[model samples]
Target: MLMTGGEGRMARIHCKITPLSVYLVVLAMYSTLMMLACLENEELNRVAREQKQKTAAPLQDDMAIVRDRRSQHGKWLRTVDDFFKRMGTLETTCSKMVSLGGTYCRRALDNNKVVCLDEDVTLKSTNCTVYSFGIGADTTFDDQMSHYGCDVFMFDPTVNQETIVSTNLKNERFHLLGLDIFRYNRTHMNEYPDGKKENVTGEFDTYDNIRRRLGHESRHVHYLKMDIENTEWRVLPNLVEGGRLEGVRQLAIEIHTMDIITAPAHQVLPLLRQYWQVLERLTRLGFLRAWYRPNLVLETLYYVPGENRTIATCFEVLYLRRGPVY
Candidate 1:
């Protein structure tokens, strides 16, 4: 048969191509494409992992990164919310309770302690007892509470022996203890000694030891008031942990802000923790904030120049135990 050069070339190609050969060519191409795709996917995954490691948090010891993320001011604001939620909810608890003394002795409520009475409580005012943690020579509340028939036990290391001997003049019902209530048992030197000595040795007492020493092991406290100048933070948590607050019906505490009282940029980690510990323990112990009064006076200012707009960094909060008092 006569054929052109193009026809002859086509006939040769057709002769060389068999079905098995065509299938082998297709299989080779597919295998090559799969190998390329696998390599590309592996490279992409390695790049992704490297980027993730680079963006991760710094690698360091757990102790170095331990910190409190909550702000002191934010926690203080939350106390206001807690107060409203707990106030006037307990029928047995006094609703007419008030701050007896001046601004310093303010609590959540402001009714006179002497005249104020709640008949629904298990312990009556006549038979109840009050434990006052700190008294800076102020006996207004103590005097009122005494007159109303409650025995008041006051403890303050700062009070001198002369003042202690003059108990009859202050209030016969008020029993002043020389020991101070602190989270730990430590000795503190008195700033002003009777004979002009700068450092007189005084001991700080713990809650458990105080109970044992005073023979109040099984007693129930009708009221408890604290103004211990930042000591409340640690002391409250200790009380909560030791189950020492099981019998306390009412608690009036003064919370001081570390921002104003603490030294500038000093060992502030411990001070900041006090706030969190107290807040958490209060929630766990079934205690509710019944009242909160902020003291805006005596704001910290510069020695020479300052602004009066700044408010004080202390607040008086009253908490009521919700559960049964045993």
Candidate 2:
């Protein structure tokens, strides 16, 4: 089976060319497969983008409806994600701050009320008038103010009494009235100690009516303090709307954010917007936030859905009316 030199050279060439031809054919198949894969990926990406756009259209429409409703109400609404942060922030600056009452200043539990006394002469005068609301069982603040010769009028509906009681302080400058400040004039039902039924009835009146009744319609209230649990959210709006706060020089109030914090995720935005509107209205009324402290006793931390960290549910804020002494 021995072949000639020319024949052997031809056979060797055939063997090499066979493998090279097979390699070229396999290379072509691989290139085509890769091209098909690239095209398939591009198609998938295009379809995904289209699907996303279709989904976003409905969301945009819903937002438009929200915008329309906001416009109808004539309110500039804020998103819920940043509501707590904005609320916790101090909006104004106070040069001089004085803490009165309680055991200590800035204590977590039963902290002293912070007041701005920058160039303020009303609170130090003997003719100063103070209206203190929500006087549960503590009158330390009223007592201290009375020590300054300021007339302190205290109001509360849950004092286990049905009628208004007037008490004279040691300095004869304090008056206690069992009444509640509310948006409207109504009868507040006082519950029994056993929480069985509300058998006692107390009067709740608006700030305007109360001031008129006390003949303080034209008199300036040098200092006003309120700690009406969660009713402040309602009472404050009424006072601002009725222009009853125009004669007040300083306000120390506790604001509760529990409503927004405890609401369902879907309803959080509306509640936060309402809360923001209240603060915004106060700001518009020239109420500058001088100082704020968290109520550490009822400090509950909740992880809001859109917020990264937990937020405090309650805070005591001091707002000083900026402008004239009145």
Candidate 3:
């Protein structure tokens, strides 16, 4: 049974993986494990930071008063506002305002002390929707809404990143889009008698197009601000009639109302009637307030036979869709 040296070696031999190969496997596992750990930690930190900032915003504003123009007056008015504001309650007094005429706005406060509004000092917080259309015109509404926790989608087609970015609004909640909503048309025109004749540069888009570009999957639009001039008469009805009305909470439109004297004799009354019908319809739907604000003095510009260009005044209409968050 004694074996040769080759046979004895074959029976007793053992094999092991090389140390370098083992080291390589361990190194790959360690690298992968470290990467996954780092990724999870990074995600956790990001979420934590977002939550902290969002929660901290209110605490900061509460400590210090924002040094705004009417702050002192607002403070004084707030004292008076609190007493009477609670007394009347919007639900009860809003009906009175409709019939009380110019004096009713004053009725909200003292017996006779109506709010003297130079720049629309309505003093009350709007729970309804506003569709603001003009750009250069100061949007006190946007400022007021942002001060509160309500989401505001401000559209400034002027297209400046700085103005939109450096907003006091929270980056996540506030969305600003630079798009012009228009009726289906090849050419668009703006006519302002008091303001400059500026041509809009961006490609016109539809309402659906705008919602997609913004990438906000929000089903109901709380405040739809439209500064889109004459095109509103054409585009707005579609939104109201096409089940899109349910999405809008408030719509403030700087409506371009051409002067009856300036418009063609046949078209003036009909145009007025068209707007009246729209307002009546909205009111019938519980949008009880149709406010006219002369925010700007605009000139009209049109092609008038031989003149080649015509101009008229652009006015503002704040269409308040009543009821809280529909």
**All predictions: root-mean-square deviation over Cα?**
20.2, 19.8, 23.3
TM-score of 1: 0.55
Best by lDDT, which number? Answer: 2
lDDT of 2 by residue, 1-326 (tens): 33457545523223345888999999999999999999999999999877644322223443354335445552444454465555555545565666777654354447357666665423666578888887754566676777768878877756643232342354233333333454333355555558855543446777777787788889988888988778877777777875677667788888887876567777777776777667666765666566777665434566656657666778888876662221
Native-to-model Cα distance after best TM-score fit, residue 26 in candidate 1, in Å:
99
For model 1, residues 74-159, the per-residue Cα lDDT tens digits are 24323322322322232222445644654333343332232223333334665788888777556567766666677777777665
lDDT of 3 by residue, 1-326 (tens): 33347546534345569999899999999999999999999999999877654322222332132123123433322322232222122210111112111122223421111111111212234443333334433444555555654455655544334444555644443333333445332333445557855554444566777666666445556556666656676676666565666655344455565554377756654555555454434544434233443323234432234555333335433333442221
> How many clashes show up in model 2?
0
Ranking by lDDT: 2, 1, 3
lDDT of each: 0.55, 0.64, 0.44
TM-score of each predicted structure versus truth: 0.55, 0.63, 0.44
| Stronger candidate by lDDT (2 vs 3) | 2
Give the TM-score (vs. native) of candidate 2.
Answer: 0.63
lDDT of 3 at 155: 59
Model 2 misplacement above 4 A:
1-81, 103-107, 120-122, 160-200, 298-300, 305-309, 323-326
